[model samples]
Target chain A: MAKTRVPAIEGWFTTGDEPALVGSRGKETGSYFFPKSVAFSRNPAAPAEKLEEVALGRRGRIWSFTTNYYPPPEPYVAPDPFVPYTIVAVELPEEQMVVLGQLAEGADPAALKVGAEVELVLGTLYEDDEHEYEVWKWRPV
Target chain B: MTDVAILGVGMHPWGKWGRNFVDYGVAAAQAALADAGMEWRDIQFVSGADTIRNGYPGYVSGATFAQALGWQGAPVASSYAACASGATALNAARAQILAGLCDVALVVGADTTPKGFLAPTAGERRDDPDWLRFRLLGATNPAYFGLYARRRMELYGATPGDFARVKVKNARHGLTNPNARYRKEVTEDDVLGSPVVADPLHLLEICATSDGGAAVVIASTDFAKSRGTKAPARIAAISTVTPTYPNTVIEMPNFATDSSAGVKPPETTFRDSIAAKAYDEAGLGPDDLDVAEVYDLSTALELDWYENIGLCKAGEAEKLLNDGDTTLGGRIPVNTSGGLACFGEAVPAQALAQVCELTWQLRGEAGERQAEGAKVGLTINQGLFGHGSSVIVIR
Candidate 1:
């Protein structure tokens, strides 16, 4: 049997071959929300809809990028003997939302530029002896 | 417009003093009272900007400050809006006088931040956006600032040289500020030589977390007149606007922005909307102002505010900086108190400190950093979590 694959946060992205982020789409108005936009709609006039789950685009353009020089404060588990990592803000043309994710292994600020194309990929957040926590990461394409 | 007179303003010099926040608050409160030539007993109401990172006293700052100053049975309220905490406290005090609930109100905001990127209060709850941003994406404050900086360079042709100039200019002004945390002059070389905290922004380009306090005493115009406090600067407007819905920009503490597909976005950005509301309330335009104090959390963010505050047209901030338009003795000197770049961010106290600088300038008392003939001045800052603040003061 395959080992248990867990996400750091639930209902945010998928684990399938297609590998896409999970978001919410309003039934009344065609709007997308990442991390589930259940409560309210941006349109004040249109009543909020019963939100439905939708898959976000797999490829997007980099809106901006930066490197985290210092170790981030906790709840963020870093690799021991910490090394700096780059974060990318990607704008999905289909969803019209900018989502942030850590850059893939060996890809960082020095290699990335604004408007660069990127594809979503699964990366390890961190792991204990029992389980590996899977999180979405961005890779240069 | 409901007018509130700021009869006094004072600050506890910003630095890493390693003292309890209560001491800073009390000292600043006493200084403000003395500046107004009033007593603590005269303060009918006290509103405090809260400090969440600290212990019990931070949450109940109004009562804590009142108790520290020897309580005089004054009504108290506390506000928390991240960095806008100070401005929110000022707005609360102004509201009391304008509502006829109090003749005079004292506002105090103080903080002693730990050195590092400001993190959320300790907890494990995944529901907190502030914590989630840090935990999941590793989004430190500088990351967001870096994102904005990179975008600015791409869109507006702003250069690292432009960013370095802002630090140099602010440091020069900070040399004149007794209360500023870092007062030494820094050249562009100094900025370029600093280590990179975020891409396109160096260590010297960013403000640090500091320990400081600031206070203001506001009274109704009638009360000031009765007390013979002549020629005082009057706060014509205080704007604490929330972001309009469909906020498309990706700001701190949020993993994603509102998708534009749901609704047509507003014409103005959330930051620009803050100044528009203040300008409307004060019946003044940007051109009417003599000086401005903007939140310069990062050097690039300062240039961004130049457009947001209507100092120049969009994508034209670089020109303004290069032309010496935002420096002292230029057209509309910005950050005349050296801004967060020099003072370092004391969180709750930072916004109030901006007003203190403006107050001194309006009084022609800002000895070295004074904007010549400063008749009208504005202070603006956007705290994390959608808190926007702007206050207009005129002599």
Candidate 2:
């Protein structure tokens, strides 16, 4: 039997055929915020304005990328035998913002380059006996 | 703003002593007081830079230090601005002096950090971006450094060898400094040969976390003159500005950069504006700098700072380093105290340590690492969130 798949952090991103990050947009200023700033706008010009939840662009260009050779400290959960992973900062053109995520599993770090296009996908951040923890990751387009 | 004189500066050597942070802070404060030729009672204000690691005393650091030094009922203020805490404390003290509330002030900062990478406050804090980045993406401090270093490589053709050269230069600079933690010289081969912590950033290319403390004694110029202390190193300006709206760059502990889709980005990038504000306040420019101390969290970040602080134009830092313009004997020597590369990072104490080095250089007290005829100096550093710090000192 397969283990249950669940989001590592709930409501931050959608897991499906076309995964997209959940972001918030300022009604007045049109500024976008990731992880959805529901309380108020972050922009000083429109601080009191209401923010609306919106889906961010699913695809972006790789602004820059790097591979981590060592495991990060807690609250980062590493596997028993740790495997290195590549992290990417992707520039979403429509949003004019840069968002960070780990490169999807099986994606080649050597093939990654600045300005290369990548799309959002769901991948395992870590797993336990009962469940597979999912997170938003980037994959080469 | 009127200038305030830095009458004395002192520091406890940077090392992992695994002792109570108060020991370091009290030692540095006493040293600064003695160096200023003033007793504890002379301080009208005590401003402490806070450390989050040491529990309650670290939180109320100003009162903590004051009580330890036998409180004279001096007014106290404690500041916490991540790595810029020290400068924040200094800014608070300078404010009181300029407001005529205090004639003399003691600014102190100390830290007792953990062994490995600086981690976020312990908890299941999903809302906090600092924790979110660590838990969700497992992005450590070196991850951000790796991103910036790779960007530099992609943007300016900066090589791993170029990054290695930075450690080599700083190690050589650290050799002559007594207070530096890593006092031995390091070759480029040594740096390149070290383990790779982050891609494009070797283990040696990154700074370490160490326990340390630093302090400064400052006073109104009039008060300094009355004390017969003439021609002290004066703080010409202190820039504690925040990032303007639409900060496009991805800073530490943040998962995303601000969206420029709605609002256009600021005219000056956040990092550039840090020193620009100080230059504007001091009525000075990059050309006026005789020496400098910049936050070198990673070797490649130093190259980024060369452009950020206007030492050279963007993409020209590698060329500047190649020309030996930022070395100890160069035209405008930077990080003559060996910077964070030598001292490692002690959070609250790091920024004040930069100021301490500048004061020593401006006063011609820096013996071996001294930049000859140094009269003007600048220090620039940034902390997490939106805290920006830059201070200019002139003799």
Clashing pairs in 1: none
TM-score of each: 0.97, 0.99
TM-score of 1: 0.97
Candidate 1's docking class is medium
The interface RMSD value for candidate 1 stands at 1.1
DockQ scores for all predicted structures: 0.77, 0.90
- B289 Cα displacement, candidate 2 (Å): 0.3
Per-candidate TM-score, chain A: 0.89, 0.97
Which 10 consecutive residues of model 2 chain B have the lowest summed lDDT? Answer: B170-179
DockQ for model 1? 0.77
List candidate 1 segments past 4 Å from native: A1-5, A39-43
Model 1 chain B scores worst on lDDT over the 10 consecutive residues at B256-265
Model 2, span A1-141: residue lDDT tens: 899999999889977888899999998888999868888788988879888899999999999998999988999999878899999999999889999999999999999989999999999999899999999999999
Candidate 1's displacement at residue B336, Å, is 0.9
TM-scores of chain B alone in all candidate structures, in the order given: 0.99, 0.99
